[model samples]
Target: MSDKQLTELLSLINQRQDRLAFACKEIADWIDSQGDRPVAGKIRDSLKAVEADEVLVKKTLTSLTLERPLPRFR
Candidate 1:
């Protein structure tokens, strides 16, 4: 695919990741309200990796858009 298409796809993936993270947080909040602090904490901890991966995705997207052109994939 072209670089432009790849960038768009990555952008969409990043957006989905953000939404997933938001949903997870909402679920965690509900669980905490239900007095399951441990489960909620675990959920929050698990989100750490998702959050970190988000940063990496953002960086890669930036590089893909701004750096030299990449070879088109078949």
Candidate 2:
């Protein structure tokens, strides 16, 4: 795929991830309110991984959009 396409794909993926993370946090809050602190903590811990992955995705998208493209090797 072309760089432009890759950038677009990454952007979409990032948006989806953001939405999922938001929804998960909401659920975690509800779980905590219900007194299931352990499950809520687990959900939050899982969210940390998602947050890290989001950083990497953002970095990749930035590189794709801001850096010059490498020459094709064909």
Candidate 3:
């Protein structure tokens, strides 16, 4: 992919990570308020995905930064 495209994708990926983190935190808080249960366990698993997404985003950013492409003027 072109550098511009990669940059845009990185921005989107980071944005998604941020959103997921916010949602996961809120869900965890709600679960805590509701008391421990089987459902809370499931919610915790989803929160773990947010952590994974952060790692994925970091990987994507590393790959994007290591790549080089022809410059485009607009």
Give the count of colliding residue pairs in each prediction: 0, 0, 0
Candidate 2 contains a number of clashing pairs equal to 0
lDDT of 1 at 72: 96
Which has the better TM-score: candidate 2, or candidate 3?
2
- The pairs that clash in candidate 3 are none
Error of 2 at 61 (Å): 0.5
- Residue 15 lDDT, candidate 2, scale 0-100: 94
Model 2: per-residue lDDT, tens digit, 1-74? 98889899989988998999999999999999999999999999999999888768888889989869677998
Residue 22 displacement (Å), model 3: 2.1
Off by over 4 Å in 3: 66-74
Instruction: Between candidates 2 and 3, name the one with more favorable lDDT.
Output: 2
Of 1 and 3, which scores higher on lDDT?
A: 1
Write down the worst ten-residue block by lDDT for model 2: 51-60
User: What are the TM-scores, per candidate, against the unseen true structure?
Assistant: 0.84, 0.85, 0.60
Candidate 1 global lDDT: 0.92
Model 1, span 1-74: residue lDDT tens: 98889999989988988999999999999999999999999999999999878767888999889868557999
Ranking by TM-score: 2, 1, 3
